[model samples]
Target: MQKKALIAMSGGVDSSVAAYLMAQKGYDCAGATLKLYDNPQCSQPGERACCTPSDTEVARNVAARLGMLYYVFPMQEEFRKNVIDKFASTYLNGGTPNPCIDCNRFLKFDALVKKAQELGIDYVVSGHYARVQKDPDTGRYLLKKGLDSTKDQSYVLYSMTQEQLAHILFPLGEYTKAEIRQIAQEQGFINADKPDSQDICFIPDGDYASFIEEYTGNSSAPGEFLDTDGRVLGKHKGHIHYTIGQRRGLGISAPQSLYVCGKSLQTNQVILGKKEDLMSSSCLVNDINLIPWDHLDGPVQCKVKTRYRQPEQPATIEQIEKDLLKVTFHEPQRAVTPGQAAVFYDGDTVLGGGTIVTEAQLK
Candidate 1:
């Protein structure tokens, strides 16, 4: 019997080629493009979007070329509630949010996987640049870094469970970006040269503050800019406009340069301090998810990344309290912000990860 697979086509070169590869391997395949967002509020009628009409067109065309069934699953409501609303609420509460993670957790992995199961699909395939492997010893599925280290997406995917890993396939995991592009070019895909979506798809301009305000229909009020000593430095435009370690757009001049050390919605204040104030030796993580194992009750040496795009740093993982993990970096890490993911890695394999809850409670 042919193995049935549902390929998530984002209409990018990576996903288009992923679908092509799966079909070439003789998997019973269907293509799906998740409509994650409505037309960008600010985009012109004909503008391209990550999962907009144009993107769906590209996916449909590719599916046609490959002679596979294709469909656009309208998941805008799920995306709005799980991703966009979560993003806005996080910012409102003085925390930076990673929407892509929410999208994957709720929409792709949760919702789409359920759909695949109902349709009798054996596997859900995506173009994420990460690999899912099975440990021969434990027989547990592991999420590993892609062959292209620079394009590795294992960090955001650490939330995946062994079951999710078991049913998911990443055809692009073994290929590099250059090779994916070459495949797309040779296949004569229309979006072969399309630029990867760099900005958040819904907020293409990258003006997160404005996007939040416009989307929520409520403006964040101006707040006080306070120095490390708790003295008023200036008035900030809004609390939502600043994030940890932000140095530019402060709209003020000081004797020495200052960075955003913290934000407080309770007091509506933005705290500024010297760059050195940003360094931290540890942080606490919550909402933990462990892969390849059940718990982290004991200490484990692993590489930890406090933020996406930052290289992993050596750290000791300790279970300090219920639902909490303590990570002590060998060197002081700067701007260990709350609300970001702290993914742990052992070699290329993801041990697990969680949301950063607070700075390490160093007494």
Candidate 2:
């Protein structure tokens, strides 16, 4: 019997090419598009929203062209509970959340993997630009950066477990974005030339505060902006409207530029300070997930990426407690925000990552 695979098609050129590659490899393939959200308020007119009707239609068309069975899994409720709710509550609690990580953790890897198992599928495939390989020495799976360095997505995928890595496939790991697009064009995929979705799929306009307010039906109360010394600077619209390291739209005039340094949920204050004040040398990470090893026995020197777009910095990671890691940077890192992931890497291999909880000044 032929091995079976389920392709999680997002109606993009990358995923379409992924499905095509899997099918060409002689795996009995099926396509699935996750219907994650449906509210018109969450999407803008004339904008491409993942899992929308048009996206699903394109995915279905691609599946038909590939002669593969296709299905739409309605995951709106799960997405709301896992991604949207977590995003809103994290902001409400004065933390910056990465919903894409949550989506991959809870939806694609966890939920969809279960769905594939139920259908007797041997593997689940997607279009992520990351690679997985088994280390022959340790017989452990390793997640590494894609061949195209600029398009690597291993940062957001650090949460994948060894089991998931064993069964997941990334067909685009070795292919560049341009190659994927060309393949899609050759295959006549409808979304071959479609621009990649930029903003959060649900919040296309990028008004996070407004969307959270409308979704939760509760507006954030106005708060005071404070300096590092707890001195009042000015009033802010709300704490939710700002993030650490933000400098613009502060609605305040000062002799020097001020950046958001922190937020106090208890006091409902947004803290602003000079750029130098944003630097932190160490941070405590929780909800830790280790990829290359079962446990981090001692301090390990590696590069750490605090945000998706930020460059990796030299850091030493030490396991201080169960489910806790202390990442001390060689130099002060700016805007070490809580609720964002601190993904550790050893060269191109992902060592592991976790949620950043708190930071401390350099000694």
Candidate 3:
């Protein structure tokens, strides 16, 4: 019997090539693009969106060209509830949110799994640059980095579970971006030269606060900027307009340059201090998800990354309390912001990760 697979197509070169590769391998395949959002507000008069109408048409055409079945999954409500709303709320709470993680957790992996099950699909395939390998000893599926170092996407995928990893396939794991583009060209894909989406799909301009205000129908109220000593520095535009480690756009004059170190929800104030004030030795993380094992019996030293593009730093992971993990970096890390993911990596394998909660209690 042929193995049935569903390819999550985004109409880009990577996904188009992924779909082609699966079909060529003789897997029974179908293509589907999730209609996540329209972004009627954030987009300008003429702009290409990540998953807009044009992209959908291209995906549909590609599926037809490949002689496979295709459909559009209208998932606006799920994307808004799970991703956009959380992004706005996290900012309001003084923590910077990573919406891409939420998108993968809710829309791509979880929601797609349910959809595939309903259609009697045996496996879910995507273009994410990651690999799934089974540990011969424990027989557990492990998430490993892609062969391409520059295009590894294992950080945002840290929320995947054992079951999810079991039924997922990444055809681009062993290929570089250039190779993927070449494959697309060889297959005569229309989007062979299509550029990758850079900004957030919905917020085309990257003006986060403006989109938050428009989407939520609430304005960010003006707030006070306070120094680390609790003295007034200046009046800030709003708390939502600032994030930890931000140095520019302060609109303040001081003897020395200042940076945003923290925010106080209680007083609605933004904390400003010298660059040194943002450095921290440790941080607490919640919502833990580990891949290789069920739980950590003891401290494991590995490389940890607080942001997606940042290089991993050496750190020690300890499970201090239920649902909480402590990461103590060998050197002081600057701007260990809350609401970001702290993904732990053991060489090319992902050990686990959690949402960074705070650096306050770690002190």
lDDT digits (tens) for residues 1-363 of candidate 1: 999999998878888999999998999999998877664463422233476666778899999999999978888899889999999988887778898888888888888898899999999999999999899999999999999998999988989977788899998999999999999999999988998876677886678999899889998899899998999999999999998999999998899999999987778999999999999999888888999788866899999998888988999999887678989999999998877899999999999998887543221
Using all chains and alpha carbons, the TM-scores for the candidates as numbered come to 0.96, 0.97, 0.96
Per-residue CA lDDT of model 3 for 134-188, tens digit only, reads 9999999999999999999999999999989988999999999999999888889
**Pairing residues by index, what is the TM-score of model 2?**
0.97
By TM-score, highest first, what's the ranking?
2, 3, 1
- List where candidate 1 sits over 4 angstroms from the true fold: 39-49, 359-363
lDDT for each residue of candidate 2 in 1-363, tens digit (9 for 90 to 100) = 899999998887788999999999999999998989879866453365565677778889999999999989989999999999999998887889999999999999989999999999999999999999999999999999999988999999999999999999998999999999999999888889998866688887789999999999999999999999999999999899999999999999999999999998778999999999999999999899999898998899999999999999999999998988999999999999988999999999999999998642111
Residue ranges of candidate 2 with Cα displaced over 4 Å? 43-48, 359-363
| Top lDDT model | 2
* RMSD of each candidate relative to the true structure: 2.2, 2.2, 1.9
Better by lDDT, candidate 3 or 2: 2
Of models 1 and 3, which has the larger TM-score? 3
